[model samples]
Target: MSEQGFKYSILASGSSGNCFYLESPEKKILVDAGLSGKKITSLLAEIDRKPEDLDAIFVTHEHKDHIHGVGVLARKYHLDIYANQETWQAMEGHLGKLDLDQKHIFQMGKTKTFGDLDIESFGVSHDAVAPQFYRFMKDNKSFVILTDTGYVSDRMAGIVENADAYLIESNHDIEILRSGAYPWSLKQRILSDLGHLSNEDGAETMIRTLGNRTKKIYLGHLSKENNIKELAHMTMVNQLAQADLAVGHDFKVYDTSPDQATPLTNI
Candidate 1:
């Protein structure tokens, strides 16, 4: 990886809303605009970026938790909104409130190049209108952002296998989610094959697929009500320890806060 290559940051990552910022000196992009426009703006400001500085916005799905501020942000800043046809159609009603000129539909699997960065969207197992995850590469550096998937399929595993870093969902602890205050239906939904990934699942998946290049992981999309940071980390640690993997030595786990921005990392 070139020292001058692209940089990425997790502005805010959790159940309430998820957003990430990726930038090179010349171009900038946002992945998922789940937060409100004002909040997103404030986050961008904290990172020394303006909404107008973004060249495009890529949405992973149509869920409100992923596209809440997409329309407003794109419309207000006149930035391009790139999504698959299905995702765009699913969000058409909400998107119509924004300027039509900003909408750009490109099928998943088609690489979208933004100057120094190459981006590819791939399918993820999530309950939404065409949900997808993203792989980003610049220079010799690359990473895959995989989250909100209920289970990690073989295909998804293949995509994540070659990455240097992974921003994955460690949504909840299995025991916690099963016995928490949530109703049966909600609990069932979360445990379903199309719901979120549990902390144990995340650890096992990482242990099974992690390569030497995969040195850093940001455990994202945690359920604030059902999962606690220490518990989630400890569960993952126990799971990986059985496989002879140590957290800080093998690969570090960074717990993303629901109410704060996570620090930038080098892959």
Candidate 2:
């Protein structure tokens, strides 16, 4: 990867599971490990990386699809795992045994430095106990990973604004979800403030958060049943057009997948 900026890839992203690989000049890390250990291992190989190459695993929440393989990877690779105190408490049972030094607790809304990168976690409106999203900075470039939140509050937007790249969730099409096969209670939950962002919600967030510094946007954590890549991309395109922004020229948008990894991108 280029030494000028950060290199990253979405290993897998969807309701089934989500994992992201990020490499700085001095550190290689996994933002989440939601897939099986075997699956995550294979995905890392696709990017010419191995589990042992990772310096740490920073978890966003305790959701199964976001943490299924965290324990396994940490144990197998002897990698450090970092999360907020409440998230540690909620996910401890799922992680099994670990050396005392393997676990690192960080406070919310605080920036922690590892090597050349600075990472900050802030609260998000999600059902999981103390769920949060992350913003990572390396020198002048910044990247934000915002997902699993039903709505983006002004505070959250302010925190993540002007990032060079974003991996934000454009989870579902509201109409399709509203009229789909899911039960009413489930639909209600998905649409609630503590759930996931709809396509429209995601677009609005981009409009508010994108700035002169923003360039690449990855729409992730899509719903397999209620969303398709084309539809989600179109929604973002249309909404962004209304703001006088051109998709390919103003900024590039990439759709992430659950079954595969995006090419390693530099920002």
Candidate 3:
């Protein structure tokens, strides 16, 4: 990790929980506190970082798997918590009482600069109150974190069109999801435009997202019941192959696991 780069680790990402550790030389932040405070803190410690070291925590939405640890972590570290007003309101009953002063709201589509980073939030397709994805930029390099969206809009894609690295949701395979044991309504929901992205949907999104500037793109939010890592990986890779984009030579793709932090990614 050089002093000039931006770095990140997917602390945890899946249906169960979602958290990330990101930093530059002078500033550090966490995106979503979806796990237990203890678990997130422990993951930070693994990277030689502490909850107290973070400048802020950005909540993507009000879902339990996205804000479960926000209140606890905010109280523990006295950190700034960023979310839209509606999302903050939706999050309140679930996250317990948070200190009023700790809350900060950023307008969607506006770039907000925090310490050494510039972050822009854009609305994403999801069945939650004001769910969004973020683009983090510094030193002319950018890494985007986008998950839990059923589909990506062209506007949202334009916001993160030039990422150096991206962590995107590859939630399920259509066949597996359709034929699996989930209830019919649940299956329909997953297949809906506002639910979650299938492996094919995620892959098609990647094809549009891949550019000369892109280096690494991580496939995240795989469903344990409806998706396997190998299958999810092959599905996306095969799509790129059809597009004549070589994986290793053009860019890299890796699956993110719910139980472990992905390796440190520097951009």
Predicted model with the maximum TM-score: 2
lDDT values, one for every candidate: 0.82, 0.93, 0.86
List model 2 lDDT by residue over 21-124, tens digit each. Answer: 99998999999999999999999889888888899999999999999999999999999999999999999999999899999997889999888898988999
Model 3 superposed RMSD (Cα): 1.2
Model 1 per-residue lDDT tens digits across residues 36-98: 999988887776778887889889999888888988888788888889999988987876476
Please give each candidate's TM-score. 0.93, 0.98, 0.97
Candidate 1 accuracy as TM-score = 0.93
Q: After superposition, how far is residue 135 of candidate 2 from its true place, in Å?
A: 0.7
The clash number for model 1 is 0
Please identify model 2 stretches exceeding 4 Å from their true place: none
- Runs of candidate 1 exceeding 4 Å displacement: 1-3
Q: Please list the residue runs of candidate 3 whose C-alpha ends up more than 4 Å from where it truly belongs after superposition.
A: none
- Ranking of all candidate structures by their lDDT, best first: 2, 3, 1
Q: Global lDDT for candidate 3?
A: 0.86
Scanning candidate 3 in windows of ten residues, the lowest lDDT window is: 257-266
Candidate closest to the true structure, highest lDDT: 2
TM-score of predicted model 3? 0.97
